[model samples]
Structure formats: C-alpha cells, structure tokens
Target chain A: MSIGLKKARAVIRATLSKGREMGLSPLSVVVLDPGGHVVAFEREDGAAPGRFAIAHGKAFGAVMLGMPGSAQMARAEGQAYFMGAMNGLFGGQVVPVPGGVLMRDGRGRLAGAVGVTGDTSENDAEAAVAGVEAAKLVAEA
Target chain B: MSIGLKKARAVIRATLSKGREMGLSPLSVVVLDPGGHVVAFEREDGAAPGRFAIAHGKAFGAVMLGMPGSAQMARAEGQAYFMGAMNGLFGGQVVPVPGGVLMRDGRGRLAGAVGVTGDTSENDAEAAVAGVEAAKLVAEA
Candidate 1:
C-alpha cells in the first residue's frame, strides 16, 4: 500500500505535469488499493468538484473488473447491461467509463490501480496509463 | 471472510428484527476482513447514503486496534491525533466512528469485524455486535 501511494504520487505528478504542459486544466488523481479502496488522492487547483468522486469510482472499477475502464467502455457491445448493473452492485462505487488503469508488478501481476479525471475520458485514461508506465509498474492483466 | 460476512448479515437481520419490533427505520450493515477489506455489505432501503463506507472503515479499525469503535473514539478524545492519523495513513480507510464492531471465533479469538449504520450509533454498534454473536462467534479481547 505504501509503495502504491509513493509510486502513485509520482504518477500523478508526472501525468498532471504533462496535462499542464499541454494547456490542460488541473486534474484529480486517485489511487486504490488492491482490494479497490482508496490509497491516496490529490486534487489539483481548479479541478472540477466532481472529479474526486468520479475519478475514484472509475479507478475502483478498473481494478475491481481487472481491466482499464476505457477499454471496458470501448469493448462493451451486448454486455452493456452488465456494466450498467455494476454501479448498483458496487453500491454506486463503480464507474464504467474509461480513464483508469491498473498497476502491475515486475512479474506482470496486478498490484493496484490508478485513475485520472478532469478531462475527456480518453485524456484521463491516457494520463493514468502514462503514470503507470512512468513508474515502471507493469499494467499486465 | 465468508464467515465474517455471513455472521454480519445474520447479526443485522436479528438486530433489525428487534428494531422493527421497537419501531425503527431500516439499517445498513457491513463486514470487513482483518486487513480492512470489505467482506460483505447489505443496505436496507431508506438507509443513509454511503453508510457502507463508514461501516467498513469502523469495522476495519476495530479489527486493527482490537477494540470497538466507540472505545476508540473515547480514547481519541485524549490522544486527539490517533484517529485522524490512522485515517490519513489508511488514506481515509480507517474510521473511528461508533458504527463498527469486532467479530470473534469459536476459540474466543478475533476472526474479523462488522459495522452497521443508518441508525443511532448505539444501535449500529449493537447490531454489529449482535451479528457476530449470531454467527456463534465469541469476542475475547
């Protein structure tokens, strides 16, 4: 968990820095434990008020479902009902949209997850994946 | 973990049955693993929003500290930083509120924990304790 927090801090710092460099507004970053509980959170200046909850939920869903939230959204064809039902199943703790990515270990095992929000879904997902890669943590399934 | 969830649900059902006889609103119940991961949760209609999260954190703190949440709250009064520090350390995953209780096993050892919300803290605590008891589990220390 501690490693998740530390590595997540760097991830958030790097990703958010990139967003800023691209003239993107401030953002919120959330990290979840292996069991999908919040490990750390950072809300940048001027980030949307709802980003905290939304980002956390997306990140949570990422690890809970063992996939990228964006990829899940992209792949949904007939199983959309399953995605819709998850919010209720998780007690509203899950967001099926993309923008969150799972963290992995050297052996390509799931370690934790990270989420980024405050921009388009693609932007958020990219930021999260970038963060994971920057930390050298594998995001293998 | 399964046993903890089973006991937690049974405790909540019994407590709520009693509450109905006494004329109370619906309740929400939660159970946690020794490591603070949620084992299970149930929310009766009309329970307050996000009760499960609070209950989970409380139960987790009880297991980690080997005491009830209320007692922890009492101690926090003098220690002040204890509760907040734990919440921060756990990234807000350990709450010292009153709705959490501990679970024990046949050998009188802690097996896990339970938490209840959506009612008075006293009722929540009672329900949590009752759930563990209904599981035929004992609480020693």
Candidate 2:
C-alpha cells in the first residue's frame, strides 16, 4: 500500500509530462514515502539543484505532517514561528508550499506524497495532482 | 561541461539495466554534478531508503575529493582519522567505497560522478562503471 518504486517513477515521469504539456519551466519532482524518505526524484535539464531541495522539502513537510501542501501553507501563515521551528527540527526539510500533494490508496490509506517545483506554487500543485492521479492514486492537494 | 538531465537520467537507466542483467540486487543510483550537487537520483523498488543516502554519500565523496571511490577507499584505510574528519565536515556524505565512480568527458575533464548501492561493493562498482560507460562517459574507478 506504500508508494512502490514503479509508482514513484511513474509519478515523476507523469509530472514532467504534464509540465511539458502545460509549458511550465523545467521542474524538479520528488516522491517521498510516508516516513518522509525519498523514494524517487528527478530534476529536469534546466532545473537548478536548489529546486530538488525545495521540492523535497515541500513533500517531506506534507507527508510528515499528514497534511496537504495547501493546509501546511495556511498553517504556516498563522504560525510562522512554529513552522520555522519544525523546519529546524527536520534539517530545513519543511517547505510550506502548494506543490506538495499527499497520495491515497484505494481504501483511502496514505500512500506517500509528490512535490513539484520550477513553476508557480499553483502550477506546481496542479502538476503534482496530475502526476498522482495519472499513477491511479488519489491526490489530496 | 556539466552533467545534463539527459545524461543523468541515461546513467540511472543504464545502471539499473546493467544491474538487472547481472542479477544484482535492486539498487539506488545517484548522479552528482562536479560541484557535488545532485542531478538525478533513483532508488529501485524494494531497495531500502538508506540505500539512497549511501549512494549519494559515495558519489558526493568521490566528486568532492576529485578521486574515484577506489582511491578514496585506499586513502581511508591509511588515514582513517582524516577520512572521519572529512565525513564530519561534509555532514557524513563521504562514504569511501568502491561503488562511487568519477565520470569524465571525452577530453578527460571531470563531468560528474555516479554512485550505486544495494549489492556487494565490487558488484556495485561494476554496475557504476557499466552505467557511466553506457552513457558514453568515461568511468574513473
């Protein structure tokens, strides 16, 4: 029921495909297991190294908190100090942004998460959802 | 020239392909740029999460030291304290093991490095060389 390697790679491929279809800039995509460990990751040709960290942070934060990126962003706005502390606790892997999407399996159990970077927050979120859905998993963005 | 996404992904694909052909264990591969930044990474299905960190550390250590993993291992044997200090300096990203291979361009300039994990050290090094060579880059192992 976790995010297996096949699904993780599929999510990365689909995310990049959707980004190309939408004409978004090169992107970095990261898939993390429920434990906030990287399952798979890729950075597009033009994507910078920092993009990977951001994408990973977003996904790690969402997965660790059991909340979607949007909710994390909202919470961050109201509790900036708490968010900062959490980031420190996790070695700065908490990015409260809209690009992180939690995944659910057939029975609504948590699978993992996908994070996208390289476009605006909203665009990144859109691509993340597209990728998770393409892999036959529900995206809670 | 730096490691581009095309070559990076090719390296990972070829590495996994070679591992499969050799009947090796599932592997995690990491490609790091000359500057010690990640360009691409993938952990095969069933591979433990720690494999990614180990692979990354190997490649990062090789690239940062401007030496192949074999050389690093040899040096570590003779200078364990120095190696330990280097590991601490780099946040434990220095894994002096044979699975890390430095990549070189046609002109003999450093392109990047590849790290492989999930098998015996010799088998991992073999796969790393196979992958870098398959991508038309030279492997310095």
Which candidate achieves the best TM-score against the true structure?
Answer: 2
Q: After superposition, how far is residue A24 of candidate 2 from its true place, in Å?
A: 1.1
Error of 2 at B131 (Å): 0.4
TM-scores, each model vs. reference: 0.51, 0.97
For candidate 2, write residues A22-90 as lDDT tens digits.
999999999988777888888888777688789988999998889888998898899989889989988
Where does candidate 2 clash, by residue pair?
none
| Candidate 1 residue-wise lDDT, B2-105, digit = tens | 34333544665665565566565666665555555544445554455465577667777787777788888887887879778877877677777677777666
Model 2 lDDT on a 0 to 1 scale: 0.91
* DockQ (CA atoms), all models: 0.03, 0.71
Q: What clash pairs does model 1 have?
A: A69-A98, A70-A98, B11-B131
Stretches of model 1 off by over 4 angstroms after superposition: A1-141, B1-5, B139-141
